[model samples]
Target: MDNVRTDKWLWAARFFKTRSLATDAVDTGRVKLDGDRIKPARAVKVGDKLAIDNGSDAWEVVVLGISDKRGAAPVARALYEETEASIVKRENDSQARKIYREPASTIKGRPTKRDRRQLGKAGE
Candidate 1:
């Protein structure tokens, strides 16, 4: 199709695992079309620009095709083209993330029962 619902396009393009997830992102202001925030049902046509923020990462893409059905990564990739600046920025962000790993990731399994007891006694 020449155009499709924003959420459907997002899902078909493999941006989100499901249409509902894409719709939720759109509703929450995480997705924008043509530089303006839009509803999930908004129509997206080829050449339209989109900005998507997915917590740890963001993307800026130009729509190249429209489809309602999800497909392989290579096929889905044809639906949109990422901008050069977006690619550079994403790479920089990824590098920064690697250099500054989350503190939570360093923590191993949950505290043992003995550890919990010690913590409770220490708090007294």
Candidate 2:
């Protein structure tokens, strides 16, 4: 197809797990088309620029093809091509996050007794 709905393309490209999620993301301004915020129903054609922010990582890509149907990862990848600068920026951000990750955020599950005691002591 020459064009596809923004949400459909996002889902087809594997950016979001489901079409509903893609639509919600668009509604919430997490996705943009050609530098302007757009609705999920907006039509996207080949060569259109998109900026997508999914909290953790942001992507800047150019639509290389349009598909309304979700497909395999490799096929989905072919739907869009990320800019060189975007790739470099994402990688740098990832590396910075790894080097500066918060120690407290790394703790998973419930806190141990000692950890609770330490937290209590810090609060006092």
Candidate 3:
């Protein structure tokens, strides 16, 4: 009988920085409740499963606690339990899908020993 709104809980649990952001994410089809679309004010209780797609990755977590007010990160950490699969997939997607720029290899073409010796005399 002591449940909170889905979006509000998401924000309280630190899934999103703000309640409005959580509501927007839910309204935009990025957040789901037990495989169904949910409104921002939908009541949520313990054990309810939520599937959220955060652009590059998706997550599935089971509700463990509920609150309407945002709290500290340490307190927020107790609100849900992210599935092992979600953690693995998210980490893999984050590592594999990222684009990295190596500063040492920024310039095009190969740098010869003479070029290496001069460091920046390529236009000569």
- Identify the leading candidate in terms of TM-score: 2
Candidate 2 lDDT, tens digit per residue, 13-118?
9999989988999999999887788998889989899999876789999999999998889999999999998999999999998898754574588888888787
The list of candidate 2 runs beyond 4 A from truth reads 107-124
Arrange candidates by lDDT, highest first: which order? Answer: 2, 1, 3
lDDT of 3 by residue, 1-124 (tens): 4768888898888878778888899999899988999898889989999998755468899988877778899888898899998899888877765565343454568867765766556435
The ten-residue window of minimal lDDT in model 1 covers 100-109
Model 2 Cα shift for residue 104 (angstroms): 3.9
Q: List the pairs of residues colliding in candidate 2.
A: none
TM-score ranking, high to low: 2, 1, 3
Segments in model 3 whose C-alpha atoms lie over 4 Å from true places: 99-124
Candidate 1: segments with Cα more than 4 A from true spot: 106-124
Q: lDDT values of the candidates? A: 0.89, 0.89, 0.82
Instruction: Residues 1-124, candidate 1: write the lDDT tens digits.
Output: 6758999999999989889999999999999987789999989988999999866689999998889999999999998999999999999999998998764464468977776676678669
Which of the predicted structures, 1 or 3, would earn the higher TM-score when compared with the native? 1
